[model samples]
Target: MAPQLDPGDLVVRAQRGEPRAVARLISLVENAGPQLRDVAAALAPHTGRAQVVGLTGSPGVGKSTSTSALVGALRKQGKRVGVLAVDPSSPFSGGALLGDRVRMQEHATDDGVFIRSMATRGHLGGLAWSTPQALRVLDAAGCDVVLIETVGVGQSEIDVVSLADTTIVLLAPGMGDGVQAAKAGILEIADVFVVNKADRDGADQTVRDLKYMISLGDRRSPDGAAWTPPILKTVAARGEGVEDVVAAIDSHRDWIDRSGERDRRRLQRAESEIQAITLEQVRARLGDVGGSAALPELAKRVVAGELDPYRAADELIAAVGSG
Candidate 1:
C-alpha cells in the first residue's frame, strides 16, 4: 500500500506537480474526512483568487465547444485558464463517460491551459462533492480563470449558479421550445446568456425570446446597482462571437466590483463551503456507526411495509446521535 499521506505533505507534493499527490488530494476532498476538512480550511484563504465562470445549458447545445472557444480566446489574451468539465453519472453503472476532453482537443498541447473532466459521482446539488477543492487546486496552480462546464440543465443545474461568480447559460436556436422552455431557475441565474450557433435559422428569434424572459426576472442588483445581463450570439465552432462573450465576462466582473457584490458573493461561497463540510462530516460519522448498513436494511423494511421510513430514520438518527 502507498504510505499514508499527511495533509501538509500532500499539499507540498501537489504543488510540485506530483500527479499521485494531486489524485490523492482530490480523493480526500471527495471523501471529506475530518483531516480533509482541516486541509480545506487551511487552503480556503488561497481560494477566490481565480475567477470561476460556469457554463451550462441543455445537452448538445455546444457548451463544450463554447468553453473551448472561450478558453482559447482567453489564452490568446495571455490569461492562463483551467477548464473543469462535469460529466453526468451513468444511471446503470454510476460512472461517467468523461468525453468532454475529446471535444477540446485543441488545448491538449497548450501549456497555458489545463483541462480536467470530473464525474458528478451522484452528487445531486449541481456539482461533484470535490468540485470546490478541485477549483482550489486550479487556483493555487496559477489559473487566472476557471471555467466550469456542468452536466447541463436539470434538477442539479441550478447548483452551478451558486458556485460561479458569473454564470452563462448557452442555447441553440433550433432547440424545441427555444427560450420559452428555459424560463425556470436556469434563466434566472444567468449573469450572461449566449445564443450559441448563431448561424442557425432562428438565432434572432432565440435572442429576442431570451431578452423577454430576462426582463421578467428581478433586474436590480442586490447592492442597488443597475446591472443587466447581456445576450451575446456565438458560433462557437467557427470561433465567432467569442470576443463578445469575453467582454461580457469582464463587464460582469466590473459590475461586481463596483457594486460591492463581490465581497458579499465571497461570503456566501464561504458559507456554502461550511455547510457542505458540515454535512460531509456528519455523514462520515454516521458511516462509522453502521448507518450505511442500517440504512439499506431499514429501506428494505420500509419497502416490505414493515416499518415507516420516517420512524426508521428517527431511530437511526437516535442511534447514531447516541453513539
Candidate 2:
C-alpha cells in the first residue's frame, strides 16, 4: 500500500535524518490517524536502537536547560540526539502552553540534534499520550539517545520513569525539593537524582539531604539487584556539572546492561504500551457501533430502575464483544 500523506516520500526522508521529515512523522504520531498503523509497521525494524533517558522534576528545577546540556553532551560524543519536552496542555485547546524551545536554541542549527515540545493533554502522568510512539519515531530516525523531558508536575513525573531506560529526577537548592521528592515517590522510581543550580546557597545541603534520605531507605535496584541511585549536582545555566550527570547516567546504563535489568524494564514498558493501545482501540471501536440497541436499551432500563448499572454494563459489554 502507498504511504500516508506522502508521494511515498516522508518516511524515506525521515530515515535519512531530515529534520523536517522527522517532525512530520512525529506530528502524524501525535494525531494518530489510521495511517499510523502503516507508519509503525514501516518503522518497526529501525527502532529499538536509541537509548531512552527521561528527565523530570518539579517546576523551576531547570529541566529544560539540563535537557539542552545533555543533548550537547551526547552530540559531543558523536551521537545523534532527540529531545521531547513535554509541556502542560491548555485546558481549552489541549495544546502545549510553553514549548521550552527557547532554552535549547543553542543547538537549533545542529543537524545532529532534534528538539520538540509536546503537550501533556490531560495524560495522567504529566506526559503526552503519544510519547511512547513518538519515541519510536525518533529511534527510527537514527537518534542514539532520546531524551523525554516531562512537565514539572511534581509526583506525576513517575510516568516518565516508567517509559525511560534511565530516569533522572532534577532538584534545586532552597526549594525543599528533597522533601518534595520523597513525597512524590521519586526515590522509588529514580535511577539518578540531579541537584541542578548547584551554585546556590543550599546546594551542598540539598545534596546532603538527598544522600541522607536515600540512606534512610533502601537504594536497591528494582529486581533485588545491588545498584544505587547517584546524587549529582549541576549548575545547568553555566552548563556546569552536567557532564558528571551524563557520566552517571552512562554508568547506570552499563550497570543495567550487565545486570539484565534493561531487558526486563523494556519488556515491562512494552507490555504497558500494549495494554494502553488496546484500551484506546477498544474505546474508538465502541464509538463506531452502528446497530447497537443493547447500549441504548441498557441505558434506558438503568434510568428507569428496571436494571442496575453493573448489570446493564455487563450486557453492554457482551453486546460489544469486548470492544
Candidate 3:
C-alpha cells in the first residue's frame, strides 16, 4: 500500500525550493487529492508574492518559443521563474499533447527555473481547470515570477486575463492576426503585444495594423489614466528584441501599481475564484440531492404544475444549504 502524504511537510519542503516536493504538490492539486484543503491552507501565507504573467495567442504564433526566450531573459536578471504551459490534452493518455517541457529543453538544467506542462483536459478558455491552484503552488514554492502560457485556443482563450497580473498577446506577421485579434476581443485584454517573427516580410505592416486597431480602442486605466499597449517586434527564436519586451512588462507593472489597478484586478480574481468554488460545492450538493428522492419529487410537482420552477429551485437550494 502507498503511504499517505503530509501536506504540511510537503509545503515546507516546497518552500525550500525542493523541486520534487513542488511537483508533488502540483500533482496533488491537479488530481484533486484528499489533502487539497490542508495543502491550500499551508500554502496560503507564502503566496501572492510571485508576479504572474500570461502569454496567449492563436496557434502557430510561437508562444512557446517566446515563452522560453522570456524565461531566459528573466533568468538573466536573477529571477526565479516558474512556467505553467497549458497544452492540448492527448486523447489516449489525457496528458499534454505538445509537451512544452520538451520544447524548452534549453532551460531544463537551470535550477532557477521550474517548468510544468499541463493538459487542458478538454477545458475551454485555453487553460487547464487546475491552473490557478497549480499557480498558487509555484508561487508558494519561492518563485519570484510565474509565467502562464495558455493552449493558444483562439477566440475562447481570454480566461488568462482573470488569473494573470499582466497578459501578453503574441502575434506573427502575415497571419492576419491584427484584425483577427480585434474580432476575437484580444485587443482589449492585451497589456503588451509582440509582433513576433519580425524578420519575416510584412512585419512592419502588421505593426501598423495593430497600431491602427489600438487607436480605435479606449486604452485607459480604470482611473482614466492613459495606458497604451505597446506593439513591439521580436524574433523570439533568435532571442532578439526580448529585452525590450521585458522592459515593456516592467513599465506596465509600474503603471498598474501606481494606478491601483493591481489591487482591483487581484480583488476581482479572488472573487471569481471564490464564486467558482462555491458553485462547484453547490453542484456537488445538488448531485447528492439528485441521488435522493427529493429531486424526482420536485420534478413531478413541477410537471404537474403544482409548483413553479423558481420556487422549486429555491427549495432545492434550501435543501442543499441544509445538507
Q: Where does candidate 1 stray beyond 4 Å? A: 1-6, 13-24, 31-35, 89-103, 122-128, 177-181, 286-323
Question: Tens digit of lDDT per residue, candidate 2, span 98-153?
Answer: 44455456677899998776655644632535778789889989999998886545
**In order, what is each prediction's RMSD in angstroms?**
5.2, 4.0, 3.0
> Which lDDT values do the candidates have, in the order given?
0.74, 0.77, 0.82
Worst 10 residues of 1 by lDDT: 89-98
State model 2's lDDT. 0.77
**What lDDT score goes with residue 67 in model 2?**
81
| Pairs of colliding residues, candidate 2 | none
Per-residue lDDT of 98-137 in model 1, one digit per residue for the tens? 4544546667557677776665655565263567777887
Cα lDDT, model 1, residue 172: 89
- The total number of steric clashes, by the backbone 3 Å criterion, in model 3 comes to 0
- RMSD (CA, Å), candidate 2 to true, equals 4.0
Candidate 2 regions exceeding 4 Å error are 1-9, 88-103, 122-128, 152-157, 221-223, 303-311
Judge candidate 2 at residue 296 and give its lDDT.
71
Per-residue lDDT of model 3, residues 1-323, tens digit only: 44677988998999888898888899888777688899889889988988889888877787878888999999999999998877443111224335544647767678888888765554453253477888999999989989888744553346655588888999999999988888778888899999999999999999999998889888766889878999999999799999999999999898888988888888888887788778877987998998897888899999999999999999999999999
What stretches of model 3 exceed 4 Å from their correct place? 89-103, 122-128, 152-156
TM-score of each: 0.79, 0.87, 0.92
